[model samples]
Target chain A: MINRHKNLREKKGNFWEERLGLRAIINFLRQKKVPLSEHTIWLYTGSLILLFLAVQVITGIVLALYYKPTVAEAHASVRRIMTEIPLGWIIRSVHFWSATGMIATVFVHMISIWLLKSYRRPRELTWMTGVFLLIITLGFGFSGYLLPWDSLSLAATKVGTDIPRVIPLIGGWISKFLRGGEDVGADTLTRFYLFHICLLPLMIFLLIGFHIFLIQKLGISHPLKYEMRGIKVPEIPFWPDFVLREARVWLIALGVLITVAIFFPRSLGPQADLMAPTPAGIKPEWYFLFLFQTLKLFPSQIIFISGETLAILIILLFLGLFFFLPLIDNQPARKKGKIITAISVIIIIYAIAMTIWSLFE
Target chain B: MKFKYSCLSRRRFLSWLGGGWLATFVCSLIYPLFKAITPPYREPDEVVLLIKEVIELQPNSVKYFSWGIKPGILKRNDDGQLIAFVGVCTHLDCNVQYLPEKRKFFCACHEGWYDENGLNIAGPPPKPLRRLFVYEESDHLIIRREEKA
Candidate 1:
């Protein structure tokens, strides 16, 4: 049997030879196994989130083919997709929902890791990189919002772009660059499209590589408290163990996204009427509604300053605090403290409250 | 020495055989898994409409006809011949109107202009008005409008 198999391999030649080479890589991976059990499900969660991001990139590229970036052409192009292009609606819908999915998964991944205290010790850099990734993901959503160039999109863009305008001396300049001029125009759409499709994705790819490399290097973190039994924790290779679980989660996520896309394909309201009065009930995407509502909750003027400006300041300050959290909360012990728990509860309450406010407002 | 060599080679062969199966399984699963998650595309049918009777639509006369999801407009030219165009303008795609005094299909959006024949004459219009497939069907006007593909 051995002789016959060897002869068959010889007949197959280089293709079989390549397979032989992969054996060495597989052996290396096997030797570096970090213990994975059902308890450490967060690892699989992170992997699933990355998988969704990959899906987003692939669908985004396909949608870009039919999407136009010019202000004059943008809305018309979207209409063409609905009316003329083959399967154009499906392509656009996938791109739309996948973006929402990517952000949703990222948020879940972040909160799970934070709750698990997986960001402590060796994983501090991982946590920081994730924070950066979250900001970039939001940037992706914001820039992509204006591509449709309809009334709601335009209003949302105006409200969103204004958030960055509270950065003191640089606020006006940043808004100008973001809008590609004084207001949303041909240059604005083109700039946003380039950023959304090119710059942000490139950054995400590089950061994701680093993120994965760090995960492999550091190995999966065990649950906050776990004891090794006498028989030793049964270890499984990540390729099959963690990956198979991730595939199941991905399938479920895909099913939900498709159901939503088919039932509620992203809408295209009337072409943006600049001369007409701003439409009522204007709001941002669901994810950002919390912040939008928070901004609205403020008084017309806070200490003689515009409410919008003050709200912007508060958001920036919160972001600044998030970025420097590792440095600020550097404790030698891995145990959670009262301070961290209190802060976490406050954040949860604030997010929930703002979300409810947004719905009502 | 020969015995030792054979043992090492056997182990290597088994490792290679196992690795080959695993790689094939993973690669095959990934492609279909990705495809299953992707949204499927469906093409809509194309529609065309034609004019049958020249209703002496006076200059600047606006009449709405069911085209697709939206309505289309029919206006009489200064020559008093029935000239029909999609009410949706090519520029920014706002529904347009025939300003009888203006003698053109005037888009309220950015004030885009179109001539009697629906040729965009001014403003940011990149193309002429999309001409509907119009024809006479047994003395009645028949328009061919493409369905969503």
Candidate 2:
């Protein structure tokens, strides 16, 4: 019976191969290899991000079934989901945790790839696409934050959306456009809702698909040290070996996500009140704290220009330098690469310091 | 020669397929962005601008409030009529404030000024402040920007 089953499977495989070149595709995948190194731990961050995104998508879909986007119904629907729907709180909590996890892991993955010089040579497009993915992920966070329509989120959204009004030209229009007129009202809610769930997902799906295709085509980049030494390194096949290793990471990430979701379910704040003054100490999300702190350092005006505008532009320029690193330093040099690594380290340290200080402040 | 021809044709077929998919996806993505930027303009059910407690506000007092999505001002005139205008200055679009003592609206950004009736009174304001049509209920004021002629 086992021999007969094998024969049947062989026949089916042959049928697909004959029509669709299935065997060729499988062979290509089998031949793919990822280098084994101490840096393998960093490699896991990519898969960790993917795992969190999967969790986010699944839980987000489930939550959306019950979540309302209108200001009047949004808070109430969230409350009902937490208190009434079976396991809805866990689902929502998991989604929240997964979003934070995705952002953290994606940021780390980008920096790792940047430090590793993975954005070099044939992978320039890959680097640009990754930058875009990071932007979209932040967009996801910003848009999703207001879904609950809680007072804290509403105030944060108001301040967050208002930041763009400081830009030189078209600034006011940009803010008004984002809020769907003048303020965060029903129009703003619907816009953010559509952005978080629909437009962003569509963009991310396309970008991620292309990103993966580029990585698969280019293969992962060797560490700069190995390249500098011109040393031969060992590698493991992508399927069954590299893939199985990623599964282990996914399992660990899932465990932590579930543990957090179960132990500390997400909080629902009070309903939004437009008339009341914003509650004090209204800090933005952790990822944005660095920028928020930076903005605070600027004066109201800078030599006839809006100081906030100038500060934001400078920050944008700093980020743009990182985004275009591949093009900036193509044909990599050890000295330049080291400088970049040092800068990345400093940025990370500065970000952590700013986040903690903002919390205390 | 025949093999080369077949290879070219196969590659062309794949190109066509990929291009078709790309075009469809691009159109789908761009549509929503257009939708999002263009705010929906459904006619409001009742264009009432109830500022709550018309009598409580002393006459000649300017009450600043939101008229729907726009910042608005409602002043209880000495004659007991409530006059309303959009709070945005006609120049630079900076928010204007009412200096009731001066009986004028002021824009601090560039020194633009308007009279209590929303006519530009001084300082680089090329146009008058936009007037809003409003009616008074027993204790509230109603604004109808699109009030019929």
Candidate 3:
């Protein structure tokens, strides 16, 4: 049978060879294991992120068909789509909430992986790529929010873009680049539209491709405790068992998306009037709420150093630690999951508390 | 390695079923986006009034109909003459309404009002109501744009 298969492979070359390649792949999957534990549920977070991303891509592309990116046309076009187009509101709402959903799943997925200590050893690049994905996803959010050109979106965007200006040396340049000059205007719209629809999408797609490739290359990591105990655990086949489970979860997520869209259709605020005083209660989208609130808490200056600058720099420092996590946790003589656990706990608490505080405030 | 998958597992069947639903959802979503991209419909150039007869329209009565995407009103005064006006309030472009009780067209936005003659009476409407050409042809009233009103 092997000889016959080899002969057919030789005769048909690459095409037939590919047909016979399934067994090798199947055997690899069959040999591979993702250990089952009480913690196995967290494994679905990555797939959930992928599913939400699929939602964003589909709805976003559809939205692009009707959305005009220019300052004059943008708000009216969104209004036109909502009022005139058939079920366009639902698509827009789904796109909006799905973005929130995507960011959330990313947060959960990152924190879960960190708590699991999955960034150890061979998964270092996976973590790095994931960090990139997280940042790009936020980039997606910030840029997309301004596309509607609403009063509230405009106010929040001003606050968001102003953050990079506090970075000192390249601060003004970064702000200028983001806003396309001195301030947010028509040029800012064009720049953000390019970033939202063009550059950020490209970057996230590449990063996601690399991240998933790495995940598959080095299969899902078991918790540190699982490794420490040297306990043998049975794992189901990745192709059928795990994939079907993921599919089931995706269905649930879809139902959730539909429910949210039906009950809470996203609203378009009045067109941005830059000449008017900014609205009093304008806040950034929920994902940025934590940072938004943190910045709000800063004093004007701490002993001549801008307190806002200090707060931003401190956050950047933590981000740096997260970026170089694999080296810090894995490269040393002693593998330090304990330090990771402590940091993860602090980050989670800070994020949730700040998020809730921002909501109330 | 030999492969044997003669039996269809329950999970596999469920996955396929769920996958089928997702595929349907995606298609339903994408088709509408495609449909929405077409040029927004314009109402016929001339809206021939089929619902009400000119005889049925008593003096001081109002009739409303859509002209393309714009809202229009045909107000018949005590003289039994028809006066047609675009219902858009000039201030913020909100749709104005015929408030026969007040004997004026009232804009809820900024409390702007136009008198029965389509002249701005109260508040922030900078211009008078726009007039549309109205003529009766063979027992049917048709509305068309006046080239210069």
- Write down the C-alpha DockQ for each prediction: 0.04, 0.01, 0.24
- Error (Å) of candidate 2 at residue A289 is 1.0
- Residue pairs of candidate 3 with colliding backbone atoms: none
Ranking by lDDT: 3, 2, 1
lDDT of 1 by residue, B16-77 (tens): 89889768756753553344344445422233333433454456576667566555776655
CAPRI tier for the interface of model 3: acceptable
Number of the top TM-score candidate: 3
Q: Which stretches of candidate 2 lie over 4 Å from their true place?
A: A1-22, B1-149
Q: Which stretches of candidate 1 lie over 4 Å from their true place?
A: A1-20, A31-39, A227-235, A332-336, B1-149
Ranking by TM-score: 3, 2, 1
Q: lDDT of each prediction vs. the true structure? A: 0.73, 0.82, 0.85
True contacts kept of each: 0.00, 0.00, 0.33
**Regions more than 4 Å wrong, model 3:** A1-32, A331-336, B1-40, B43-149
Where does candidate 3 chain B have its weakest 10-residue lDDT segment? B1-10
Model 3, C-alpha of A301: deviation from truth (Å): 1.3
Q: Could you tell me how far off, in angstroms, the CA of residue B129 lies in candidate 3 after the best superposition? A: 35
Best-fitting candidate, measured by DockQ?
3
